[model samples]
Target chain A: MKARLIIVVIVLALMMVVMLVPIPYLSKPRTHHITLDSQRYEYDPGRLEVHQGDTVIIDFTASDVVHGFYLEGYGIETRVEPGLTKRIEFVADKPGKFRFRCSVTCGSMHPFMIGELVVGPNTTLYRAAATMLIGIAGTLIYLWSFKGEQHE
Target chain B: MTKIDLLTAAPWLKPILRSRLFQPVLMLATLAFFVMVILTGLFGTPAGNRNFGIVFVWIVWWALLMIIMVPFMGRIWCTMCPIPAPGEWLQRRGIVKRTSGKLSTLRWRFPKRFRNMWLQNIGFLGVAIFSAIILTHPDVTAFVLLGFILTGIVLSILYENRVFCRYVCPVGGFIGLYSMMAPLEVRVKDPSVCVTHTPKDCIIGNEQGYGCPWMLYPGGMQRNTYCGMCMECVKTCTQNNIVINVRSIGSDLTVAKERRLDEAYKAFIMLGCAILYSAVLLGPWGWMKDWASMESVANWLIYAAGFLFINLVVLPGAFALTTGLTRRLSKQTLSTRELFTHYAYVLVPLGLAAWIAFSFGFALVNGSYALVVLSDPFGFGWDLFGTRDTAWQPVGTTLIPFLQTGILTAGLLFAINTAYKIAAQYSQTHRQAFIATLPVTGFMTMVTFILLGLYLG
Candidate 1:
């Protein structure tokens, strides 16, 4: 019983310590500028040009039902419900133009909920293409590993 | 035999469709596919926001289990379990290539003194902490399914028996703990037959196959803790000694002497989990968002610790303190542990009812997603069923939600009544005639109604 108690206490203490320990770098803030009632978004400057050290905040909202603001490559995602404003922040440490899209299952035209983030020096279009290529490669690899030998 | 009797008698009537191994593999593959789907649906396309299919699967299946299945069949979910199948397959593969006698025996004996209901309690905590995120998010559905698949495979290969199902599976733990209040049970027809039999086929499998995977001795089985209703024991018993019996609701609680410390501990854990699940899932907090946003390792660690604190520290601690307080008040020199073990039995029904109430709304709303399976089994289009295109609107206007809330309230009252009865029996006090059970019961009843309203409206 004593040993068990000691173990529990130690485990809890370690957890507390880890939880309190802060990450070294400040989280970069990415702005997702959006309009709620209008169901539209205007990324201030509609396109962003940022260096690797900078952060961007996507300050956004939805006009109708809840719309999720999600960027695939950088792993930044959050919900933008109607009548509510949401800001998703992320670092542009990686020099790449990532595609941002709405995640929430919206209406019929939800399939066209696509947007692009331009990163680096006037190479945003190039970065977007590269990111798309990487996504394609990742998909192919996953299919190769998981799919049955019949495909081979 | 009558229809009811025939159904009861042939409990193992259905042939195990997929090998225990297949379920886990399929679950893993399905989870992986869903993760990819979430990523693509969220990131790859413009109209990706409508993938409620995965979320529907996670919430509806579990809701069905808690509401209808666990109360009726007693942990049969652990039998057709998809989580541990991969691990068992790995174990089988390893064992097949080796000489049967050459391998070192791998059975580890559970220490008699150390055995406690901590695991069950911990399991409930685990489920409660994650319930908010798991119930709400479509993306996290993949993760939860993957978690089960990983757990199933890992435990099956490592342990001699289904340790994941018995000791670790959060859902299994909850079902086993609260299922004490359930009326139906599988038990031996004759104790004498069990006593006379030299080799217990129920515990150790005969030429037929592996016996009770949870290691329950059926002759002494009184409660729903260890039985997975695998029916291997039923099949192996030479005398045909086992039968599924229907009895009074709280029959298991009346037999106090047979209660184990682990079981008593599990009851408290189930209660704590019930409260915590209600707070996190139904309560208006940003708990769901935090759970999703937290890094995976950190999220899981927090959940594990929270589980330990609530199940192991808080609930048991409270129950023990209450028993101690009662003893002092009554001037009775009863052992605190003994008193606690007896009183804790009442909380089982409360936990069961709370689980039912909490899950009822989600099941009703999200169960419509199952139809999507017919249209797109392999993610291909097949509109012939017409079920695939249908989006679930709640069955009736406000009527269904109101009816559900009433049913939930009734269930909670039943739980409190069961608790009060046990308390009266143990304390031997004048049934405090005016002592209102209504305040707490009423609060929970209101909470259930409000949650249903929010979910539906």
Candidate 2:
């Protein structure tokens, strides 16, 4: 029984540590506004075009019921609520047309709630340098946090 | 031997094929093929993905369960389950090691008082509640793989027998319960063989290896409650007593003369979970989606707790309370607690039947993904069938979903019948009480169908 308890505690602790410790990373800021509802996603354009080395910031809200924003290839997901804005920022390192869709069940047109992101070549060297520095700093901070623990 | 003997012995003639080792190998091969299909469909050409869904439903889901899980070796799916492979690897590598061995020393002490199936009941409901998202989304396959790896890791570190299988696995509980209706079972050829043998190798592992990983003492096993049919016991027994035999359907449905309190509580919990799962999976309430997608940590926590309370605490509590009141009105001697505990075993079959119904629908929809690899097993289009250019349709076709619903309904009716039989076997007066509960069951089933329709529609 005691072994079970110890195991449970250890597992819980590991999960907590993994969840709480955010990795340090840097990327350029690029803002995007999107409105979603059961029927459709209202954005500046259906296609989000950005350069490779830029941070794509999606500031999104739902116009109707709640809709979940999911980018399949990147493993990024966030929920967009009506009248409430949610922010998601990620680095566009890969050059490709990545698809995004609404994960939450909305209505009859839920399956058609799809969007895409097009990444092109890096336009600014300064932005790339800054992002690299931030990424390095983030990595150092993450390592520092776990350094005190005994590594087996 | 007489013709009757030959007829009975016909099933035994295929002994080598039906052997425990053979079954596990067959199951593993089938799983491998299924995995390969899934990988191909996900990465294969558009043509491959389209036909994958069809083959998954017609072949893998129906054929595997009917031909393998149910008939060949009941609940054996839980034994060779690949879901926990990743988890086991992680645990074995000491990626997640325990700091204190405090819990290890006290592991042998089994708590005499606390064995309620509330956890099992709640676990099933939790899985069912998520079935909407899980079944429809293509990403669930990855999630399933991740879950298996995590479970494997946990089990590798734990010393207990089938700890992951018994308490943690949602599918295991479903199979263990529903398999009560499956005709195949591992049994002792002679009761005397079990009794006369000293230091029973069946229960305790011999030189060959470990004993029953599911931890069932074959002597006391009344039903398939915990048997994984790993057949470790069959091989261990020096007496060569254990025989895989066929029996009447629903043989395990008979109520025990005396029931333990925990076992009884488990029955009620199981019943409640079945109702809760049916409602969440098949009910039409859009609020459920909102509840699942709630962004606030506090709100999500509350929703989860509320769900647990409904399935684990409130439903069983209410049923047990009602049973107690009925006993009181009939001028019976049993207390409410005692009555609740005593009648708990009756719900096992009912719960299992509901699971089978739900699983059948899911399997039908997703099992076809297994055959998507026929044209391109290695993502290399051999074009063996030439019909590869067909556009893949999303699962949840009108006809397939409709058929699935009907199958689920049939399973629900079977469960209700099992519940009625169990009640009749237990208390004479309670037989009417059990029949009275049919309306409630019907209401829940209706709610489930509506929910499923909404999700599928």
Q: What is the TM-score of each candidate against the true structure?
A: 0.60, 0.56
**Per-residue lDDT of candidate 1, residues B1-457 (tens digit):** 1113322556554233112333344456645555554553333322212344343345555676777777766666665555665565465454212212211225555454434456655655555566544444444545666667677666665566677677777667667765666666778877889999979977776654456767788888877666876666756677777776766665666666676676777766665665555444333333322442242658756765776687778767766776666556554345877767766665666566656765664444345545654454333455547766765332332233334444443454455454444444554333221121222233333443443333322
Two-chain DockQ for model 2: 0.01
The number of clashing residue pairs in each candidate reads 31, 30
Q: List ranges where model 1 is wrong by over 4 Å.
A: A1-152, B1-53, B89-105, B108-116, B131-140, B258-280, B283-325, B328-333, B373-388, B424-457
lDDT of 2 by residue, A27-105 (tens): 5646544432322332334457776667777777777778777664576778867788887888877554454656664
In the order shown, the candidates' DockQ scores are: 0.03, 0.01
Worst 10 residues of 1 chain B by lDDT: B95-104
Candidate 1, residue B375: CA error in Å? 2.7
True contacts kept of 2: 0.00
Cα error, candidate 2, residue B63 (Å): 9.7
How much does each candidate deviate at the interface, measured as C-alpha RMSD after superposition? 25.9, 24.2
Q: List the global CA lDDT of all models.
A: 0.53, 0.50
- lDDT per residue (tens digit) for residues B26-77 in model 2: 5556567557545644554333223342245333554576445763357767
